[model samples]
Target: MARKVLTVLLPLLLCVIAFAGLLLLSIPIRNVREPPSYKYGIVLDAGSSHTSMFVYKWIEEKENGTGIVSQHSMCDVHGGGISSYAENPSEAAESLVECLNQALKDVPKKRHPITPLYLGATAGMRLLNLTNPAASASVLSSVNEMLSKYPFDFRGARILSGQDEGVLGWVTANYLLENFIKYGWAGEWFRPKRGTVGAMDLGGASTQITFETASQTEDPANEVRLQLYGKSYRVYTHSFLCYGRDQMLKKLLAGVLQRHSTHPCWPVGYSAKVFLKDVYSSPCTSAQRPPDYDVSAEVTLSGSGNPILCQQLVSDLFNFSSCSFSQCSFNDVFQPPLSGNFIAFSAFYYTMDFLQKVMKLPVTSTAELRTAAKALCNESWEKLLELAPSQKSRLADYCASATFVHQLLVQGYRFDEHTFPRIAFQKKAGDTSIGWALGYMLNLTNMIPAGQMHFHKGTDHATWAVLLLIFIMIILISLVMIFCFARSSKTQSAI
Candidate 1:
């Protein structure tokens, strides 16, 4: 009886070991499955001049990390930014309806419920917050209420801090350049080889400069530490309020009126009439206003087409001598040092593009840019209209804008001819706009996870079928052998 039991048990144990080895070999190494679904997110850039809505989408899950976000569609709202509607805050909410409706059609209906929607007011609202806090609150409240009415998951509407704006713009530019997480040629992801690029953003009311820096920063406030895609960065950023194109023009006009009768910053053949109040209405030029000056007094300005005077007036906007730090970039702002290449967008792109268009040549160096701006300034207003008939509304602004950019880059930031060529004037990075809105969304993913995909890696269908069959066979054979052994042992004992 003992011998029979040993013979049966040994064979059974061998069979069990063979089955276990087969199962181990047949098991899949990874969990593989198809992507769950595509996700959507929306961000509204409420800038100083206008409001624009951007729709972005990405897959739920990606092998590398979070899904790569891309701009799906864009709609520029028909009116100024919400800050402009301070008098009637309700109008600000109404102004977004057209663009919101357009976004509805752009994004599919099924995603409306889950699509995260956000609104970030830029320098425009920041100015409004300073001048009229109550109105700013009302406008923000109205927008929040309006956004909540839509099917999208309305997050919140608020003004982005200047530091946040500058840093996020830097992130957006680097993200687009693939400087953050670059894709290798061998189908793998890696960090960039050359390094991160800097960001130069000029808007209607403000301008921002940000770049990676390793030097010990004198002022901690100007430094921003950011981490994305499992990588960390230390950068210096600063936003100059009232240094943007529109406000800068106002300051230029105010300075010209205070000192001289003729406007030297204006292009030749260009002239305009504006009220004294219009020139000094904002906090930017209020100090430049005359004590007894009449607000309603009409003042007329005509261009003298002088590049030297224009550059001088543009240079006057900053105070280069007030730095308490070892090094400064005008206005006593502590900047360690400008590092890497820069992508200048927004007003920078427009001014540089206009220079290129009028000159019909690439403006590479500061000297070449100066030549083009001087040539454009000296050209009669009628000639400019003929050269760019459709740009008539903007041609008058060409020379002054160019001069301001030159002074801002060369004098203010201390960028020389060699560094100037490193600047790439671009409005968009591929199909995506180079701005803080996309960066805001991407950064938010760290806190609130984006909709992700479900993936699993396993054996193929045929292997699964074979494994399942073998598993069933093992179970049946083990059960049958146990029953036969029990019956045979009982029969032998009875006999």
Candidate 2:
């Protein structure tokens, strides 16, 4: 009887122990523990006025449709824009060394060899190319050579065209907003079902306007069709060169100043010798002449502090008479109605920030901007410097720039007072700054793939956990039945 009991109990105990072991294995097998992984990319925004290095990082295994990359760190290159070194292209290349050194510190050493580094030169380089082709080539070559010395994979460093500048800026804005995926189709947010916001980038040498319009674009040149993250977006984009605030100031000042004249656009107590060559050098101006054509002449600028005259001078730059399209946004470019809300950044944010903070203006009215500009222009030089000490040298141009901004939006872009509120003045969206650099990098990396993996951690994990628990419970019940049956048989045999 004892032997039979021992034999029955031993087999039953073995079965229970084996079942328990399998349950323990299922927990770990069902729950996969993946180590964290990261990827990084570097984008160099070589704008006309300045250069900034952006270091971006993202999780290695995130969904493809969503923009997971965020700006990790950024360092502004010391000195002026790369285009400023047209005369000395070597220095332009050298200016990036400090920024690259910072990047070397920011990105992990192991990732250096595989990390891509791209440089996209904006309108300033475009202007330089137009004015001096040889200098532009030299500058690009020098910068490319310098970048090659670093461990990062040197992607082609070249100039982005006006159309790309505008459209990519739009991409950056929408991606940051998550517009493409927020209201997308089925299991994954792969298709765009919502309207994308417009983007207005105001840089030092050019301004870009891009948005989706309801009206059909008759001219193929004006329409830009893009397929991003498996979604199709038809957009109208145009970049107006020489329309940037600084360049516009030069245009207005050049038009107003007749050799040795007191320009009404200048602020009170401001006197400077503005070069004729600098003023009329850009092709954006109707009065533009070759830089060498009037290299020897200088226009003496003395401030009169007149606001009315400033608007008049800036407005004269726009040609409202010709339009082959039903509607045009100055320079005879086909611009369908400014459909969506606009994100105006770069210089737009700076000028608006100054107006809102220093001038105490709401920035909604052309009249209010006009009034504030005149007030700043009429203010004493000492007082103006006190308000913006960092911009002491350039303070004299604010009066003109602020006034020009108002006129440009109101007259050049045909933005009404009602639509003024739609324009958001922002430099960043969360951690990412508003610029085409992010968009350019995204396009190059193929980050937005045509199809995306559907990953819902909570639902998938819960389903697996529940199913695993049920499996373990089923094994426990089966083991108990076998143990009972063995005991019953042993008892009957003993009897």
Ten residues in sequence with the least summed lDDT for candidate 1: 447-456
- Global lDDT of each candidate: 0.82, 0.80
Candidate 1, superposed: residue stretches over 4 Å from native: 1-36, 63-65, 184-187, 447-495
Tens-digit lDDT string for candidate 2 (1-495) = 797677667656765765775555444232257665678899999998899999988767652545367899999999988999988999999999999998899999998988899999999999999979999999999999999999998897999999999998999898888876553222223444568899998898899999987689977887987776555678998898888776777777667764326767777787888776676756555455553456668756678777777767767878888998888888788788878788999988888888889767666766676667667667776778788898877778777778778877888888886787788989999999989998888888877665542442323456656765666676676677677877888899899
Candidate 1 residue lDDT tens string, 1-495: 688878578658756865785666455443356535667889999998899999988866552343467899999999888888999999999999998999899898998998999999999899889988999999999999999999999999879988999998998888778776654433334566678989999998999999999888999989887766566678998999999898898898889997877788666777889799878767788779788989889978888888788778888888998999999989898888777889999999988888787658567998887787777777788788888988877777778898888888888888887888899999999999999988898776552233332223355556666776777677668768777888987998899
Error of 2 at 116 (Å): 0.6
| Candidate closest to the true structure, highest lDDT | 1
Q: Give candidate 2 regions above 4 Å deviation.
A: 1-35, 63-67, 182-194, 281-286, 290-294, 297-299, 365-367, 451-495
lDDT for residue 16 in candidate 1, whole number 0-100: 83
